[model samples]
Target: MGYVLGLGGPYHHDAAACLVGDGRVLAFAEEERFSRIKHHRDSRSAAQSAAWCLRQSGIGWADIDDVAVAWNPYWPNYCDRIGDAELIAELLGPDARAAGAPRRLTVIGHHLAHAASAFYPAGVTEAAVLVVDGSGDGVSTSIHHGSPVGLRTVRELPYTQSLGWMYQNATTHVGLGDWTNAGKLMGLAAYGQPRIELPFLHLTDDGYHLDLTRYGLPPFLGADATSRYTDFSYYRDLKLAYAKAFTDAGVPAQPPGGHHPDRMAVDLATSVQAALQQAMLALATNALTLTGTATLCVAGGVALNCTSNGILARTPAIADLFVQPAASDAGCALGAALECARRRGDFTVPGPRQAHTLLGPEYSHAAIETALAAAGARYSTPDDIAAAAAHRIAAGQVVGWFQGRAEAGPRALGARSILADPRSTTLRDHVNRDVKRREMWRPLAPSMLDLTSWTTTPHGPAEAMIVAHHATDTAHEQIPGVVHVDGTLRPQRVDPQIQPTYARLLREIQAETGHAVVLNTSFNGPGEPIVATPADALASGARLGLDALAIGDYLVDLTASNTTR
Candidate 1:
């Protein structure tokens, strides 16, 4: 029942840490925020984030009762547990260990942590849980039934049949960066037709079949085979294979940095996307039948696919769905802590539902002012910061809105976002080109006060912007800037109670622009993590030439010095 620290990685991407006390998540953060790296792929860097969590929670190292690692060194095969213990000891530091800290240390399977993450935070009495991701502990996908008793495994698929690797390979084949660039692939899929047939994926009554050999890719896990993620030769083989496949298909591969992608790339993206949705639907159907539950909760990296989540939500098979906001490997840290607490009889049935992800660091007014002064920026304390920022957006200005704690996941909610008027298509293009410096085809998302007016169907809980919905005609006419070319949007519906200030801003925008939607993106430029501190916010705002920055209760204006708008 005491404080338990959960460490996610020293071996995986998106390293993170979480602290739990009295069966509740006290603090959770990804190492990327502190390291300033996109995914913080180096798991050793997670120590800094873990230290920050303890500091943020005002809990000393001596106060921590247990430490839980999200990786199992003795799963299916044995790894060097002694090396891992040494790493953990180093992470804890000699000074802390000398103070009688960390009474117990526990390690759990990776997919089990993923399941705990999705099932516990979902706050459902009983549901079917699905964990789908790249290879984790030799398993890529699993199905479980969650009840008051806990989660029970139903089925598991080996890493060799991974859907995640299939998508990642296809992403690279189409000339999108790599596995990290799957989101770009998903976005590009909207611009093409699904005419290309991928024979590697076959949907069945149970789960689906994925054959990597069809694409000239080798098995992800085997006695002698190594992970393709770290194998450069695998990529070389992939290039040659894709070259042959493209030549046989009579299409050319798209190169990076272009206004328009090649026809073949888009078609491939579309086909893969279609196949992924179908396969996910089939798998969900099987989970529902196996667990005999009407509600479903999903986690792991693949759960971040908002397009597939939208399709699942739209289908009649899934009555209710809960997709973890921080579904990536980073979220496994939180799940580990929760699982540890539950096993120790600290957490009760139907644990607290994570209504929001504003779990990272928060700055005070004095800190914001100090940072603002250090930046030598022109600023003022507005009577109504939301009203001021909304008026600026109404004047067609892109503004940085930094409020409360930073978000825990990749998507930027109201906490740390760049807000703009969503009425003009020109504004969207301008933000993409000048501010974001990303592909023109990649669409911006929206945070709305009333989501029902924008989307055509009920798209489950979108408080996290992790699910996409077909846009209604009203949305296209009113907020084209946030709408994609395919008439779909990944929208975040603001909850007044949880985000009162942001909801107030949306209301102000409604008064001025006659719509409750505003274009909301992460408060950082290209190749940077979201701003974690006021200094980060000010520096990014200045570098990106933002019109205004609403940090805490102060409004910093930069219109006099910048004329880009």
Candidate 2:
């Protein structure tokens, strides 16, 4: 067995790991899931995920043949945090590395890894690749072409002009913090019009260029600043960076809560989203022009821009599009592993395609029972767990649904999710205010038994929540709780073949309410990472304002006063 362990993060956020053997991924996990920290910003967190991956493979570090790191310190420039042989040694510990003598070590370019994660797992023969994020390996965006034969670069852009950072600064200006709240900004964009423009940004032959002076920033970051990261924590007038970019465009700045009718925050979000989508569209089109590939794959933080992804999927230049579900930095490890496997001639042409992303850990019924028993809560061994969960949702009672394996990405695709009735318009606010205690503007996502059942899109049978979809009028009426203000929704298409449990639950809901949709959010409340273990699930279900938790064959009703009903 050619055991290849791929690692990401520990240097920054979204740390993750994937272990590959015999040309297939054995396991993959993100640090934040185990650590219970949202985007756990440490290498140790990712190292923990690596250890978990190794354990799932039933092997130790000493048995591994190679270590493939997702970041290269030498690309465009050098940084001390980049993971190399010594860094890997440090992570695995001296003892483990010592036993795995002369273990092959490999470095993958950040964007290349992103491309690999998208193209390889997607099972695409040849596709134009687009990788975008907040600066990795000194580049914010790169274009490539991927085939089972190999992956080839078309062009790479410098980090000086980053769409991701502009979006981040915009996020901060609107009261949401950067990195984590960027998606909130995406949701906010739907409420207003795009009445502004950035004067310093324009498309170039390669990609786009920006002048920081437009936002009162220098042409470049500080000399000591690493090209891969430009001071997100302590920048002077950080919000003003993107705020002025809009205020200078003759639009007013938004109020604190971003709610007022004539306010500019929503408009700024709208314009930022528009500019980003247009730029990404250009990049994807150009990738096709340069590579002459009809199929396309996108990854990286910007690839997480679901609106842009939806637009890109509809572009005539692209015959097929596949965006990795974990398009963010957490997916880089999977890409690195795929890249190493290619080098070893194990990732053959037309490589293995992912049937699903249930790559994280799963808990047994014994563990679930133990957790519920320890919590001193009311629970039951329901003969029909799915039917009971469906009844709760249909009765307008919120539920914490924990079943099978935990999902890998930020989405709660059935497995570790809070389920609610999607037919009520007030449900969104209830979940936001009473349950999640999050910003009121935050919208809820949904899982449909079939994409065609609700959404009207030419694009997919997608299981990952990486792309966006527009709702049909029928959907608007039936699933009002899940639809956003702009009539668009981020939906996960639960496959019956791979996700039988989740699909059956949806069917049960349909049997009760005539609608096969449920508002699905992560199992945890605001500011908490998605719950991983049954103990975590039990703890979150008790305090998250959920009425019941449907885990394994057991149904735990928190609202009831009894121990087992």
Candidate 3:
């Protein structure tokens, strides 16, 4: 009967909120949609979105029983670097208005919130909880043991020694934008060789350390010097050092944007990807050694690294792994909400969520009809629209599918998606050139209705295509367009109960194409946010070379617009 609100990573990448009622997630959403900014950063903007969540739930600000912010203002020396009182006061301003402002608000540590989001929802009573990301409130990564008593932090890797930052620096060095393009660097890494200019980071019993000096950067200047500067000159220096090291190691470094052998890129990508996986495993192993836990729950920006997650799942030290769909900063909202509920003794495990990203705003049939009629577009009933969209997709025509409730995370899921026939190899190239207009090497993802039927690895608990896993040979052959060069597919296995319309569409597509999966990608062009409204769908469809627009029960004539364009 109580409502708890959680907030996390404000003014940063994936700023979001999660509202929980009696321990069940009621609504969760990212700020980017309302703010129209890639990642809502302005404190005011975050507050506005939080207000929206309250309104959407038909609750008042005073109704929030407890407010848990994902970051702790009192972590050891956190105030030393960023000063204590000011940042804490600023963050607490939003929640301070709640009914006499309850004495002693719950402030969960960044990594702990991440751990809770991962482990609690996993339905695992005992598991090793591993947290990794660019940086948390104070630490970059942490390992914890989850049990009936609650989660206990066992080991921590401070921000000074972060694997996520290393990858981010490398991502920037490779010419992609930070935050947004790290995944692109990962995909591109599959194309290069790790020159090993400096040794990759390693963890020890005392603490974590990196030999940045060996990488041609000035001696480990510690956190102060690195934190003060925003420019990436130091990273550039590291890249140069890497180039020399590659030459010495008998591996050539590919110049930025220059042509290099595909095998070379693949080898380099594999090496770094392996390094990340091994480092994560070492951390998990350490957690298991200390806690004697066989299951693992992982969350954080890095947990989105499905390859690394899959590796942990197969390790002898770990038996099961659960990664929250909104694992990044955005998910901190859910953790914060859960922390509040637990402290008030109101939290009850609401059972496992069959669908994660579906916790957002959904449009009603009347609402969608109003939009379509206002836009002067033709429409149909849900069944006819689904059938027609399925037919176009089966005919190898690209369709822009924008249905109820935009997904909360970076993934489009079935809500905001551009779908095509997975059987067409040309579909991948077509999406990149005409619609996505991004890197050619970047592969598309898949949405499978009957994920179990495909020989692909047992689909992880993903309602949104968040974690990447190896595709079975049959999957690779059947959906070549969605399969990456590495033979993996980031599939969103749709369940009928979670999204009945999406499930129905999948069934129709299966009946038409003999395959249950559709080539799915985010429903937006490069540098644009995922379409949020029916008008957005039409605008994006016209802007991008889409074959059709499916907005709820309506199917706009994209073919007519395509000819006119």
Candidate 4:
């Protein structure tokens, strides 16, 4: 009865929906999951996710007390800069506007929604909430203090000066994808050195200040004609250009596919990462000093940086840290919903989430069986699928694991993942070359049985794999497959309730090998989409280097060379 509907992203990417009642999240899903698109933008997918949320809650849309959309088109000066009035109008069309009337529609600021999604779900009362991303509404970053009085902004960092843009530019410089490959730059940074130091990274009394001129040209510079940074897409291309600039300035740009580890590359990555961490620290410290709050909530695409987050957690200014799982644009959906609930007195303070990423769609055994039968594929109903998969992994076989409800974030978790033995040192390279077809420098992540059991030396537990954590010497020796070049692992601790099936498989793998970890990657091939349908799964197995495919309850062995049909 306390349920309120949350909707986000009918007009942009990462569209999603969440239904909450009684201070517990009932159901949440991203439109991309159902649509099979990397980031859902189509109206059909957005509306379908909204409708699905209502159906899952067993309530009609009209029954909802309030409908919260994570964006406000009416924000002052919004239309003047973005010039997307038609798109905004389409988003506010009859259905969405109708849902808002009579109940009083609550239009939340895009940045505030990002901060709320991080703060409310974290169950933190007083903390520095830092929202950093490519661009939200118009701002690039915002810091806030969360308390019973609601979130209060400390300062706002405009999009014109963004650390996210710096990292994205570096990503493209190395010839990687932009929005998708920014993480690659994070990984690559560990291997490079920044030849040029810019004064813009210094902290100032006005808050964290960046001297744009020191970095050569403004990030917005057009590709051919410098000084114009476009949207996020162009933002990425500019970063790549800057990387080349670094090389031209006497810094060596690490060659793609080069087996040799270039010191310059490592130095560049270290400098940028250091600057990034310092800036974040300065921002967090300033927020705490101003708000007098010890606990912190963080969101936005930049909040996804696990390394920076770990630093924030350890900072003297912060006592505890909470981050939303879908901290990226996808989370704006839930934030939009919470904003509405706040106006109605439904969401008074932070509360515990009922579930994790498992809030997405679930397939019945019957439906999976029908798909397998129609494909004419052979499968196994093993006495224990998890154990069997563990055995295959111990034997060094790569497995495509699809189970239960899919994960809501960018991570694969255990569901919709490819699992491999971490004991194989060459596993990372092999996955990149043979399976992922991604950059060789890009490292793989591990699904650890116990996050605390592993050593997070230089950096601590990367529960979300948003940041990289150093592996304990003991862990490194035991699970060589998942370790990156810098002797770290981007790990996701499998919580029992959030990932029961994956947890069981990890337990089984540990029981056999004494190490409960697997090299887990997305369940898709290069340039292809993440497997969304049973057909997609089967097709991926047919084309890739997978040894077996586990879809729901059915287990398929692709090594047999037998076609599904």
Candidate maximizing lDDT: 1
Model 3 TM-score? 0.87
The predicted structure with the larger TM-score, 1 or 3, is 1
Predicted candidate 3 versus true structure: per-residue lDDT over 76-118, tens digit per residue:
4443122333443454444644423334445777888888887
Q: Which ten residues in a row have the lowest lDDT in candidate 1?
A: 78-87
234-294: candidate 4 lDDT, tens digit per residue? 4554455565566664556555543344565556566667777777787777777777878
Better of 2 and 3 by lDDT: 2
Candidate 2 residues lying further than 4 Å off, grouped into runs, are: 42-45, 74-86, 93-95, 98-104, 204-207, 214-244, 250-262, 458-461, 562-565
TM-score of model 1 (CA atoms): 0.94
Clashes of 1: 0
Return the lDDT, model 3, position 341. Answer: 73
Stretch of 10 with least lDDT, candidate 2:
227-236
lDDT of 2 by residue, 511-558 (tens): 999978889887887778999998898888888768889988888888
RMSD of each: 2.8, 3.0, 4.2, 4.6
Model 1 bad stretches (over 4 Å): 78-84, 89-104, 214-222, 225-251, 562-565
lDDT against true structure, model 3: 0.70
Which RMSD does model 4 reach against the true structure? 4.6
